[model samples]
Target: MQEIKLTDVRYRPKYHIAAKSGWLNDPNGLVYFKGYYHVFFQHYPYDAVWGPMHWGHVRSKDLIHWETLPIALAPDQEDGCFSGSAIEYDGKLFLIYTAHYNLKEDGSKSYQEQNLAVSEDGINFTKYQGNPVIKPPLANNTENFRDPKIWSDGQDFYCIIGGQTLDNRGQVLLYKSHDIYHWTFEKVLATSKVSTVQGTMWECPDYFEINGQKVLVVSPQGIEPDGEFYQNHHENGYFVGQEKEGNFIYPQNSFRELDRGHDFYAAQTLLAPDGRRILIAWLDMWEQKYHEQADGWAGMLSFPREITIEDGAVRMRPIRELGKIRRETLLNESTAQGQYTFSSPCVEVQFKAMQDLAFEFTRGFEKLSISYQNGKFLLEKTGYKQRKITWKMETLDVQILSDASSIEIFIENGPVISERFYGEGDLELKFQSTKDVAVKTYRLEL
Candidate 1:
């Protein structure tokens, strides 16, 4: 494999957390420790394609501007370090990750085990000498268990990992640890036997409580499409319910999609200083076209979002610190149906429709159309994908972040739709409606 330099990636996002010069996936080990936010990701630096994995590190003070640190973990005799979570324990930061090893390199004999690494200063890290704290659940099948998310209730440390059974059904495995080095398997909380909404395998699992509700967030693979749902190759959604008697209780109807987007997956959440549950995910999907790989880099992390549950649904709002990147206001006024141009490709736009309206965003032949009518919102792009949602509010608010090669749209602080657009040249915004609409646009600093 030939090496590609970072300078070659023309589509590298300015404000997004991207690999310095290679393929990146799955935002792992997200935590806030000692007044700074740290993020580790699945990285391969030899080329702009997936290879033996390493843990890439970055830190941010305000969640807006980030500084890249060194590679935290690299594969030894094992295959690679896969996705996992981070927890701060007794003034030290501990990372719990999946060790994917293949004995023959062809995966004929492969195993995924849970391991640990610790850091005192949050910069340098050392692998635990007594590693592989948790072995695979099944001795005969070792390929399905991975992605350990750890948290605590102040008495004991708890971790829930995503896995699959021998019959090919997704399950979340629970474990307890008194010390960071030792762990014992407790039980299986939920499985495909409990609900068919769970697919053949669950990749990343996260459990948290908000608004008096316990939410199980997981990325399930091998789900067949139903109507407009699960139309993507895979799904990243949540099940809203409660925990009882060392088990989870979720009705099949309670499962809901988290983000209706084209390029969002492997989401991981962190509890912030102010007690907010914030999330960040890989902004690109697995099967999506990677035109930028030819330029060097391949993926980036989505902007940090704050999550809340309302009316049995999960809602996500962009973190307030993102305002720090607003450099200048480009547009702020009522406008009728017409075409307009913003100052730059990198911008933030907010819109509120006085009445039903349709807004179109375009660059060259690529276009993204958003509209509201008869209490429904729709997002469509030609020859790509479409998403629809029901909205009962009198006024519909839409917030959008447009970069050189990507766009993220937030619908009234709840459901979001993100996509990657490789169109070259300036952006054009147009509206088609009889009623007036208020629009605010800002130029981003980076």
Candidate 2:
């Protein structure tokens, strides 16, 4: 690949967390430690395409502005360092990740084992001397084990690792640890056998609690398409349920997709000091062409979102800290319905529609449309898959965050659609509605 400067990247995001260069995927090792919010990701720095994995590091005092750090973990003894989580234990930040190795040339067989790394100041890290802290569980044929999400209940530390049975059924394994090193297998928390839509392999598993309710999130593979759902090669979703004596108990039909978008996967969360559950996820999908690869970078992360449970369903909203990036208000609660222009591509548009409404964002000939009619929300752009959601409410509240190359659409009390687009020059926004719609627009600066 020819060397290219990231500053010239046309589709690079302004506020989202993307690698300075090269390839980036799954957000890993998310934790709040030492007064900084740390985010680690699976990266390959040499090129835009995926290669041997390394842990790329970034830190922020707040979730909006981030500072890139050095590479945390590389493929030293293992073929690659896969996804995992982080925790602050004993005044040190601990990273529990999977060391992946390929046993066969055809990629038919592989080995995965959990390892540990420690950081004293939450910047530089050192791998544990006695690595491979946890191996595959011996209870069943679980060779496809990886992505450990760890947490503490104020007592023993608990972990949930994604795995698949020998029969190719996706499952999550539970484990417990007291000292953060040694761990013992507890049980199989849940499996694909409970529901037909559950995929064959689970890649990432996250377990947390909100408002006295337990939620299990995972990235599952091999799920077939169902109408407008499961169109992506993989899916990220969660199950709301209860835990009983180390086992997760949820209804078979309780699983719901976390984000209804064309490019969303591998979501992880961190508990903020202010008692908020904030989440971030990869803004790219598998088997999709990434336009930014030509500019020496590939993937980015979604903006930090606060997760909450309302009406027995998970609701996600952009964090309040995002307000710090607002530069100037272009339109404040305006009811006009005509062409609005912005000098830069980074902007935010909020609106409330009581009737059918349509909004189009254009840059030259390229256009992206967001419309709501007859209780349906639709997002469409050229050369991209269409995302639609069924909404039952009479009034619709919408939030649109646009960066240089990405757009995140948040529907109040509904689903969110995040996607990537390639456009240049200034932005032209046109709004159309039968009745007056209250709109607010702001210019966002990084």
Name the top lDDT candidate: 2
Where does candidate 1 clash, by residue pair?
Answer: none
lDDT of 2 by residue, 1-81 (tens): 443347466888889999999899999999999889999999998888899899999999989899999989998889999
* TM-scores for all predictions: 0.95, 0.96
* Cα lDDT over the full model 1: 0.84
TM-score of 1: 0.95
Please give the distance, in angstroms, between residue 381's alpha carbon in candidate 1 and its true position after superposition: 2.1
Looking at candidate 1, what is the lDDT of residue 186? 89
Ten consecutive residues with minimal summed lDDT in candidate 2? Answer: 1-10
**Candidate 1, 1-446: lDDT as tens digits:** 55468666457687889888898999999999999999999999888889899999999998988999999998885789999999999999999999998668565777789999999999898989898999987542337899999999998999999988777888889999998789998888777653345688988999999977999998988877776677677789899988888689998655577888888899999999899999999888888788788887888889889888888888887898888999878888887677888646788888888548798888766788888787777888856857776665566688988887788988884468878766666789988666778888898874
Clashing pairs in 2: none
Off by over 4 Å in 1: 1-3, 7-9, 103-108, 139-142, 193-196, 385-393
